[model samples]
Target: MNPLHRNKFVAAIVAVISLTACSTPDAAGEPASTTRRVTNAEHELVFHVLEGKSPALVLDAGGGLSSSYWKDLAPRLAKATGSKVITYDRAGEGESDEVSGPWRVENAVSDLEAGLRELGVTDDVVLVSHSIAGEVATTFVNEHPGRVSGAVLVDANVPDFFTDEMLTAFAPVVEKQKADLLAQPSTKKNRQLLAVMADYAPVHRVFHRRAWPKDVPVTAIVASQTPFTDSPEAAGLWRAAQERFAQARPNRKHVLAENTSHEGIVTERPDVVTGAVEDILKIVR
Candidate 1:
């Protein structure tokens, strides 16, 4: 090799080592990261990760939504709480690969769990489950209680909260609604409304047999306005259901968000959601 070429090669190797050395690791002792990816059976999920302090936060977007849904909010939560925050797209949503069939509830939960595992997050996290994403968030916590310290349910879909009669009536309507949503160009293709309709009964049956663990802190932020409300009675039922979620465990609180509806709460009501997250932060620490 020529002498000049050898010097250039040595310089490039030195620069690479220097860059690697300069990178820092966050509290959980994992290397500092702002973005990552995790693959499951369905797709490889792209995740936005900001390593803050400790006890990270995971942003779970509602069904028919993706990590982009939390784009504006995840950063705020990380800043406010000074804790790591994670947001990602499920299969058939955002940048993740699409699935062949409908979104399976259990599989969705597994995808979330798999991502966190791949990230090597040793510390516990608070789940911010919005809209339809609530199912996977709650199910993840319920299945892996110790891994999750708390959860902030933002108008989440807690299957056990819906009555059998309610599910029976809303089933077909929701199915058609999702099929229409999937056909639209602007939607997230989460197919969440359909996933809920499919798993509501069995998920409820499993959770009903076992009581919610009282040790985990849960703050249920119930929305005042919801699309589901066609009448005063419908709105009232929605509030009642959220309240029930708050009381599911002893270490839980219910707060009614006055200004925003279900979807808007995630973006429009930052104070409401982050405040709840801060409360959970305090409770956990």
Candidate 2:
């Protein structure tokens, strides 16, 4: 794909793949919190913790983003909700150890489980996941339904959205990007990006077959413009997916972040995101 085509395709699926580094400020903007490097199986993951009380709130960034995306919002959330806020860099992102392989939700979950155990935050977790981290939150909740009390999915990519047709729509761009990345010299960022794109379709295919545990309460926040400003059909499918997720069970609510785009929800619409988390905290408490 040429530069122009790639840009358009990327904008269409911005929520699923983030090739460039997040536009959020660097670690210098991170809140005054306890930061530590947690190791698992010879790999090191950097986690930032803001002390508070349970249930602990774990913030997982979207694809291609580091914990820095939460810098401005973490401290505010910690203060407003009085719940422990935890954020970390996934393997190959930020200061975490880089491993050679495709990015899988299961591995992400393992890293999370390790971090939570190391920090002694084993229960009452309120997972706050954005964009593709939604998959991590979904798998984690299902795998450990007993631990998570509530969840907030912000402009996330829910399983219901990745239908056969949608996956087909995503293939051309994903394949072109993967091929392009494969031809380049392997840097940490390129490797991570390629690995993630390599399995993007397959992961979503699996995600589409899975469902969120009905017992857990959830809040699905949908962005106004979504991630498909260039494709109306895809945008419609995205909104419908969130609606299905919200209405599938009791204690699930769907909120529309009017005038917000997928990427802007975390930066420009922290109030909406924060409010949703506060509401979930109330129910879980």
Candidate 3:
């Protein structure tokens, strides 16, 4: 794949893989966040942490993307919400330790927990997750409910993504993404992250469902387009699930990122997402 095509193709599959698996404006003319690296034992995770007064806002990337995925939005979100916006690359994805392990949602969750601790961020945080990271954020909320004050699921993967029907539906998308990705040699290491995600996805579905946190406020934001819910039946099922998730606990809300694509919800619709984040914080606070 040409560099241009590789970039384009990378964008395309980022949307497809999350179901197979599921930003901001800034001011001051510079990024508000400061970059630093933290160690979770052998792995060195690079983070961009914005210092502010409000509860922390942690950004989780979709599979195959680095923390750079939030480059356009985090600083703006930090300014908008008057909160710290923390973004980092996962193991083997960017500067983070290429720690070898299955991409179990639990491991992702653990990494965040450890990383947060290393940052001395004991205060509860609002997890902002895009794409399949819905699984990771959702699992973290489950394992450490007290640590998460809220969550924003931006076109995020549902907890039950691996239902028999969904997996059957999701396989083709995943396979095609895998094939396209294989042609991009520069991305081979990134695919290692994908490999673990694939191995643990079904297990994550089961784990998240049985223990999804119900105490904190959650906002489910859906992009208008998603590989997981493209057709009539799939769309209906997706909407119903998103709604039910919102209704699952008190103070949950669902919004559509009108005219937004899966990636755009994070990269382009920072204003919309930040609005949702502001609203969620207002209610929870």
Q: Which ten residues in a row have the lowest lDDT in candidate 3?
A: 16-25
Quantify all predictions' global Cα lDDT against the true fold: 0.67, 0.82, 0.70
lDDT of 2: 0.82
When 2 and 3 are scored with TM-score, the better candidate is 2
Compose the digit string of candidate 2's lDDT tens values, residues 206-251.
9889889888899999989878776666667788889999999988
- Ten-residue segment with the worst summed lDDT in candidate 1? 12-21
Question: Where in model 3 is the C-alpha error above 4 Å?
Answer: 1-32, 168-186, 228-233
Writing each residue's lDDT as its tens digit, candidate 1 over 2-77 gives 4343333322211111001123355453435566667787467777787777798989887667788887787778
The reply for model 1, stretches above 4 Å from the true place, is 1-33, 172-211
TM agreement with the true structure for every prediction: 0.78, 0.89, 0.80
lDDT of 3 by residue, 1-285 (tens): 234443333344344343000012335654444666766656777776777765899999787778988887887787787787888887777777676655666667777888788777876798898877887887787778588898898878775434566554445555556566566774546566456535443664575355456678889998877543324445556667777777777778889887777766776678889899899888766
Clashing pairs in 1: none
Model 1 residue 206 distance off true place after TM-score fit, in angstroms: 5.8
lDDT (Cα, 0-100) at 167 in candidate 3: 50
- Scanning candidate 2 in windows of ten residues, the lowest lDDT window is 19-28
Name the TM-score of candidate 2: 0.89
